[model samples]
Target: MTAGPDPVAPGRTTTSSASTGELFGAVTRDLSTLIRQEIELAKAEATQSARNAGRGVGMFGGAGVAVHLALIFVSLALWWALGDPVGLGWSGVIVAVLWAIVAAVLALRGRTELRRVQGLPRTADTVKKIPHALQGHEEENS
Candidate 1:
């Protein structure tokens, strides 16, 4: 039978075999380089993601400013329209009252939502049980 090559030494390129120490050194160097490359890749991806997030935040800020300006113009237009029927002074007061009522309603609703928040109840429960769990005390199912 004509032997083609050594199946056990598939990674060995040299015709002369290397020592186990040399093989181990080569593997260690390759693994170290692979880990370094992976870390560098992660850093680059994180930087890119951070930059994208910054741009998105800037865009949102711009949109918010534009919306505020639009609301101001709309309020002014409504005030002028109402001024033709009522006096300009009464129209302004009417608009102010409407905005005040809107603010009050929003504030009350926001307070209610804040009150309803459970403040991570599940996380607190899990944290309290961590000491017991680590001590190998299995919790009985109720």
Candidate 2:
């Protein structure tokens, strides 16, 4: 069911109708602006987060290099210790074989850990549920 055009507006063209449409148009334009602003805000936040992550990764790399230098000294000490039992060449070969085995084990474990990672899965699931939550379709029947 619908109401007929206002009698005062005969052809449905009147100042009041035009004003109402103008209001609707204004609201639509404002909504579009608001959505664009929100998108820009999100983009800015994401950019900041990426910059932070890059800095963090670089810092970690620096730390890793420092640790590697420390490990080199430690390995040299271990080779010197074994030098008493075996000759220099055999001691170096033994250390090399031990490092090879350790590298293989670490590589396998690191691969497994990387495979287990699911980036932002919980956030993704929560975002997916937002529309349903906004529509008042909360869990009831389960």
Candidate 3:
């Protein structure tokens, strides 16, 4: 009698046929793409946040500079108006130092916020599904 087609032949190509390696590769590619997209999204968000932070810091710095200059003017005016009762130089120096401290605090806070936006957790979460997806694909293909 003629032999019928073998079911488990290694090179057989059934409708559901795929090698473990191929399935793994496909799943890997898909997961890599997903991770890449997620990373890109995170990077874009981080960049936007950085831009916003930069703008905010710039504005804060500018306002602080303006306030310092204003304080200098006010101190000078007060010194002149009070007939130099209190020295304007000391008041200007104190206001300038206070403004510097405030600016430094704001910059540190911004740096902390940016650091918290790192993308590793999101990438790990997405990568965690890759093995399961590959296993399922392997079973279906088998």
* lDDT top scorer: 1
Q: Write the per-residue lDDT of candidate 1 for residues 49-98, one digit (tens) a residue.
A: 66766675677568768887887898899999999999899999999998
Question: Per-residue lDDT of 109-137 in model 3, one digit per residue for the tens?
Answer: 87886676444555555456556655664
Query: Residue-pair clashes per candidate, as listed?
Result: 0, 0, 0
- Model 2 over residues 1-142: C-alpha lDDT tens digits? 4455668746554444456776677667765775576566556666766676667567756877888888789889989999998987888999898889977996786567546544444344444554564456745222
Model 2: clashing residue pairs?
A: none
- Candidate 1 vs candidate 2: the lDDT winner is 1
lDDT for model 2, please. 0.67
Candidate 3: minimum summed lDDT over ten consecutive residues — where?
Answer: 133-142
**Order of quality (TM-score):** 3, 2, 1
Identify the runs in model 1 with alpha carbons over 4 angstroms from their true place: 1-15, 79-142
Best by TM-score: 3
Model 3, residue pairs in steric clash: none
Backbone-clash count (model 3): 0
